[model samples]
Target: MIVHDTPLNSYYASTSWIINITIRKDNWALTKTIQSLSFCTIPNDGFFEGIELIVTSSTTPSNGDKVVIHYYGRLAAKQGWRFDSTYDHKDQNGEPLPFEFVLGSGKVISGIESAVRSMKVGGIRRVVIPPSQGYQNTSQQPIPPNFFDRQRLFTTIFNPTRLANGEGSTLIFDIELVSLRRRRKL
Candidate 1:
């Protein structure tokens, strides 16, 4: 399976204010539904992030092994709040961002690490990670200047799978598990 990595650019800075109004309106509608459903509260026991995902793959990942992941999900705000995408941006050298990560490693965020670990080859599960676990107090990639200071960031990882190496970080990929080859020789 070939995985294409894309840069997460700042969506907020690139778009005009007029376009944001429509997104904000849609976000408001979603927020209302979540509030009514009561699936809006933050999780206390598991990861503190407000996001969860169900991931499925064919091969399982071991510790210290670099597993490539390809995924696509959305970000939403917590209860009584909203996701201001205008301020949040993640891009590579000069491109819109796509999902890619090395499993079981700290290369990404804590929430992502936890969710990916709980997945198996061809398995899917929902992971809830609060803002604390998602991005916490970081002001780096994905999270823009004003958006980084906020309290939480939530995302749901859809059907995801492992990818091959040597792929550039600019391709939005739909990956499949080719195989899980061991690095050390027997």
Candidate 2:
């Protein structure tokens, strides 16, 4: 088989979509890979948040703490293209999916919860998640060398760009904790 890597940015730069996601922090074994990127250009203003998780920050979110977050994500590498916003999604009934959960509650994917637990409130980061902590055997990855079936990948609700099987896929997330308040121990 020929192993050829194509430039996804140059090819899938035209399509656009809006999406938002919430991620909770917890303990999880995440994978780091470069597969896709969210093309939702944040304003050039000072609001630009980098993809760096702060583990040493004080008062970090822990297990049993309810948290709120806002995020835009896509499959890692060439997998993340097109404008597929998860919030107030016009195509999906025009309502942004609300995300609030307790760390370590298994309410969200293990990869997401573990990633979120690594950040403090108001911190932004680009996290990469392995399939083990995510959908397990439920997700699919693109097949081989030329990884894009442009005609089908961008048009479907489930981006075809992110197709991982077997051991699972690694998901890339651009997450920011909007608010974090530990639930009162009553």
Candidate 3:
């Protein structure tokens, strides 16, 4: 995404502003015009800092909204090795269950919360979370049911210190926002 301010001209009064944005992706280019400067809230690079985000949806969740998401998490240090996944979890009826959380509730890691903040229902995103925003402590939720994998995860995360300090691996999560519920007013 490239953004540049349009030169002041007779067509556009001084009171109003126009911003030209050019978005380019492999072999295709799109140009968008914003009539107001208020829309300039987007960062110059068109993305948030710290984590890489690939958005496949056009909608975003708001604060206090409840969200259901399915995720597959892997450690960057061990490429192709999955540390945890919602797909591996199932109920007694053999139905898959996604994780649920309210936005801004701090039920999940900061990276996940940040990533989910911009997602729409049925949208899938792949996020690369830095160690600082990843896991400072071991997470118990979304744990693998396999006994061997579970044991390995526990020992690796906890041994007098926390996981971030122990492994310090960058986390990559493929997340899908399954459902969303707006918060009700009191």
Indicate which candidate wins on lDDT: 3
- How many steric clashes between backbone atoms does each model show? 28, 23, 0
Error of 1 at 115 (Å): 0.9
lDDT of each: 0.33, 0.47, 0.60
User: Model 3, clash count?
Assistant: 0
TM-score of each: 0.37, 0.49, 0.61
Q: What lDDT is obtained when candidate 1 is compared to the true structure?
A: 0.33
Q: For residues 53-127, could you state the per-residue lDDT of candidate 2 as single tens digits?
A: 432354578788887765554544346643222342223554444456777676575656766776777766665
On lDDT, who's better, 1 or 2? 2
Task: Order candidates by lDDT, high to low.
Answer: 3, 2, 1
For model 1, the superposed segments whose C-alpha errors exceed 4 Å read 1-57, 78-99, 137-186
Instruction: Give the residue spans of candidate 3 off by over 4 A.
Output: 1-58, 139-151, 154-167
